[model samples]
Target: CLGVAIFKKKDSVEGTREVYKDQRGRILVVEFIYGGMNFRLINIYVPNIEVDRREILEELKGLVVGKCIIVGDFNIKCSRLDVGKGVKVRWEKSRGIGMLMEIMREKGLLDVWRYENPEKREFTRRQLKEGTLKQRLHDKSHAIFNAHLVSKAVL
Candidate 1:
């Protein structure tokens, strides 16, 4: 039942699959034309295991042309910057995360929320363990990239 839902404005013209589902119910991507600009919105759900990481990243690499905004639950812990308080965690270097970072660097994508709130500690999902609040990093991070000319009004 894992999926992604997109609600678009009525004026936008939709396009074909910029990226299709590499795995059923796991990845969904769409392209749109708004104000004469192309925008690709990727919605993904990476499993909480390590095996699917390569497949996910490969699918993502295929979809990185033109303007894109990738949004999804990447079930990997990639950075300490997205972690909040109450639990101490270290950043472990992984091949999947390294690929993702490389993609971001090569494609000119930015972590939208983290860019806006650099020093702030917040969590999109939190859990209580041993009577202490531990914020899990999965839902708290979203990777949003702007590849082409973005309007000042949209900023």
Candidate 2:
């Protein structure tokens, strides 16, 4: 199960709320509206083998709407933008990566962390048993249509 918890102010009232889950419980999407803005938060755990990338991508495409945030732990790798050290693994043409890039481009979504730190390297999760770390930019996509509404102080 993809467990999620949301916290808001005491006086806040949610305008909308929804949760989407896949049959295998691997993908979970939570959407809600607060402060007059809609927000979507997705949580995904993709295994390395036997994954139907096309189906997952189609499901994701169906969910994106207007200005929102989409986040998840995608196990696929991208190019150098997602790697830190060691031998560089090429993943530019991978189907999963390509699909993700397409979504970002079509929806005008920006990888918040990459946008803020262009040349920095960071890892979200580490495999302790294998002594391996992957610098995948999993949970950092956002569509901020109103630039003036977003202040540096909020970031």
Candidate 3:
């Protein structure tokens, strides 16, 4: 059976998508596209406070394909600096977070905002005193890949 829906009253839509459960039990996949590009976006909610590095890596490997961009509130922290000094001091070296770093190194999918500007400090979790992030500050939690477009442009 195909799980498909379309709302084309005001805009053109393309492609088909399916949602299925995997062994780990806490993962969700949202596959979509825009401007003729394909994307495999996965939202993962990891269980087990201890880092299951291989499991996370394997789970990611299973979902990947051409022109992919995985996005979500990854339970693992990417960098210590993301959580301010006070919070940074409390976190022990988490092997699971380390695996996420390894995945980025193995995959050419660049964190788009980071690629464009390296100096920007990203803080996904914030304190109330810090105030709301201005609308301009919203792109920090995403990673984007454009190898498809780059190859096409080169040709």
The lDDT per prediction is 0.60, 0.54, 0.47
Give the Cα-based TM-score of candidate 2 against the true structure.
0.67
Q: What are the TM-scores, per candidate, against the unseen true structure?
A: 0.74, 0.67, 0.59
lDDT of 1 at 134: 70
The residue pairs that clash in candidate 2, if any, are: none
Error of 3 at 77 (Å): 3.0
- Best lDDT goes to which candidate? 1
Over the stretch 1-155, how does candidate 3's per-residue lDDT look in tens digits?
22212223334434636544456555556556567866555555554455454575578766655566555434454554334444532345654655666666666555555555555555434445556432212244443211111111211
Report the lDDT tens digits of candidate 1 across residue range 1-155.
54665667665575644446554676677877777777777776666566777777777777766777777766554556555643454446443677777777777777766665666555556688898777644334443221121212334
**Minimal lDDT window, size 10, model 1:** 144-153
- lDDT head-to-head 2 vs 3, winner: 2
Report lDDT (Cα) of residue 151, candidate 2.
Answer: 18
Residue 77's C-alpha lDDT in candidate 1?
A: 48
